[model samples]
Target: MYIDGKWKAGNSDFAVTNPATGEVIGRVPDANEHDIEAAVAAADIAFADWKKTTAYQRSELLYRAWELMVRQKSQLAELMTREQGKPLKASLNEVQYGADFLLWFAEEAKRMYGQIIPSARENQRFLVHKSPVGVVGAITPWNYPISMITRKLAPALAAGCTVILKPAESTPLCARAMMEIFDEAGFPPGVINLLTVQNPSRVGEVFCTDPRVRKLTFTGSTQVGKELNGLAATNMKRVSMELGGHAPAIVFPDADPVHAAKGLSLVKFLNTGQACISPNRIFVHEDHAEPFIQELTSRASRLKAGNGLENGIGIGPLINELAVGKVDGQVKDAISRGAKVHTGGQRLTEKGLSGGYFYAPTVLSGVTEPMRIYREETFGPIAPVITYRSEKDVIAMANDTEYGLAAYIYSNDIGTAMRAFEALDFGIIGINDINPTSAAAPFGGLKNSGLGREGAQEGIEEYLETKLGGFAI
Candidate 1:
């Protein structure tokens, strides 16, 4: 972890394991209350100077960081695959995606526009400025570790705010690698820090209650987001949360089933379907349900599951035994609840996967709302197909869950697509697009999915405070 511009260790440590083969990768420093407090104090001090630097200078620093990331892409990607268990190609892509954020925000740093307001009185003048929110504490999850950090880190630094990050225990190496790159870019002491501890709750509590930390951003489960949000409310600290999601990919009657299946296969199985924005629930019009299921299942079954390092591999192992259990339980429950497993159902204990926690890309047909898989976010490679009759019914079913992060419309009809796009409660609606996330777009969700946006113009707003100045001449 990077603390006060130094690569150092804490009094304690925890071993990071490779989920693919249940092998110990390495150990990360396990921080304590003192370490957490020190990081917050360092960020607070660093913010004093970092906030004073010109936007152009900060942009230069971010650009340097981006360059460093690009240089370390192969090394970092391999490290991520070993620790996080995603495919080598996906890990490499994640590094590039993470780098893009830094590059994008390096330019975006100069675009924090203020506003001028005309007062009712002729002699009065009002001006609003976007200022940094001071010290920030960011907590990101295991899935897409580097990508999540860059999404927040680039924008926060670009906005002239100092940050301290707490990456998931399972993926600490990814964060550490990024922090090393930040160090190479010559960020000043205390400008950015990373803390990993055995007691995450305690560290998180400090982030919420500490007066020195002004803003706290998190990407995790909704239950934890709500808890932290409530605690942040105690001190009235600014919060930006990216929480859980159960994304619905709706295939209308007019849509081509083959085209929809082809697209869904890519996004749905990415990261073994552990992504919060992964299309967990599928709502297809009944007329095309059979064909959709057949095509989807055929594609899913053909994908290979094994160690991420191997070539030609599609799906990888789950993060741990717990993930395996949760995914397996969901699949079993769905089957017991009258859902039929179309293609792949059981866990893989075959060659090259005997010691690993691997589940085949599963598809379930005859799925209904009563099944457990229908309601829960199946953070696995399981695609459960639910058939619907009309636009209104599909829209209602899509918004039935507490999560409203992202919803997809695969219809060719302009009117139907527009209606579904407007009616869906999710923050991001994909109109015939599976991967809707872009560096320039505002990325977030509505309802229980999350609290604020992470990319685009709105992304910078999360790290800044609006200050209005009034003067009478």
Candidate 2:
């Protein structure tokens, strides 16, 4: 753990394993309540000075950190691959994605401007100022470990808030490596702190109940995000949540099924379909469903699953045995409910993959609304296809779920695309674009998916407060 500008160890430690091999890769400190208290205190103390620094100073430090990340990109990518069980190429991409946040926020720090308001009273002038919200408590998940942390931390630091990070227990090594860069970049003591613990509830209680932490940011499931949001409400701490997504991809009759299948296939199994934004339910026009299924099945069957470090490996193991079970259970439930598996559907237990948590990339057709896979967020490489007769029916089906994070539409007609985009309840709508999010865009959900936004100008605003001042001229 890195706290108060120093490296500290707890009395006990927990082992971090490689999901690809089910082997212990390293051990990280398991923090206690005292460690949490110290981290919060350190951040609170540092906030007084850190928040007062000029934006230029903060920008320079962040730029230095980004430069360092680029310098050691290969090393960081290798570590992520070993610990997180992602393909080395994917890990390298994640490193670059994470580093972009720091680089983007570095330039954004100088853009925090407040406007002057005209007063109704003749003798008074009204002024508005944006100030840092003070100490921040951030909790990030295991998927996209490096990028998730940097996404929350970059905006917080850019807004001049000192933060105490609680990274997922399964991926602390990546968090620690990030802290090393921040330390080397000359961030003052307590400006950024990281705590690793087996039980997140304990540290979460401190962040929610403590008076020092002024804001809380989290990237995880909606259930957990709601729990934390409720706890933070007691102290009225500001919050930014990027939660669960059960995205749907709709294929319109105007579009070619083959083209749509290729696009969806590329993004559906990204990170082995572990991402929250991965398209869960695919709706296709009945006229084109057969061709779409055929192409998707062929592509899924061709994917090579193995150790991420190996050459020509496109898929890696699931994060753990539990993840494997969840995906398997979903596929079985869909099959039991009358869904047909067009291609791969079972766990891979071949000679080389016997010890790891691997699941075959699967494609299912005839998926109905009654099945578990249709409603639930299947965080795996299972694409369940449902047929739609008309645009109205498909839109209704897509908007039926509680999640409204992201949705995709494939259509050659601009009118149809515009109508669907405006009618869909989701925050992000991709019309023929599979990869919709970037550091330059606003990313979040509309309803149960999440609260608040990340990236672009809105991201930094989450960590700041608007203050109004009245003065006599």
Model 2 pairs in collision: none
Give the per-residue lDDT of model 2 (tens digit) for 19-72: 889899999999998899899999999999999999999999999999999998
Kindly list the per-residue Cα lDDT of model 1 for residues 1-473, writing each as its tens digit.
Answer: 67898877888899999989988989999998778888988899899999999999999999999999999899999999999899999999999998999999999999999999999999999999999999999998898989999999999999999999999989998898888889989999999999987668987899899999999999998999999999999999999999989999999888999899989989999999999989988988888988899899989999999889999999998888899999999999988888999888999998979888899999988888888888888889999889899888888899999998988889889998888888999999889998899889999999998888998989999999999999899
lDDT of 2 at 89: 96
What's model 2's lDDT at 420?
96
Give candidate 1's TM-score: 0.99
- Using all chains and alpha carbons, the TM-scores for the candidates as numbered come to 0.99, 0.99
Best by lDDT: 2
For model 1, what is the alpha-carbon lDDT of residue 427? 97
* Span of 10 residues, lowest total lDDT, candidate 1: 196-205
Model 2 residue runs over 4 Å out of place are none
- In candidate 1, which residue ranges exceed 4 Å CA deviation? none
Candidate 2: 10-residue stretch with minimal lDDT: 312-321
- How many residue pairs clash in each candidate at the backbone level? 0, 0
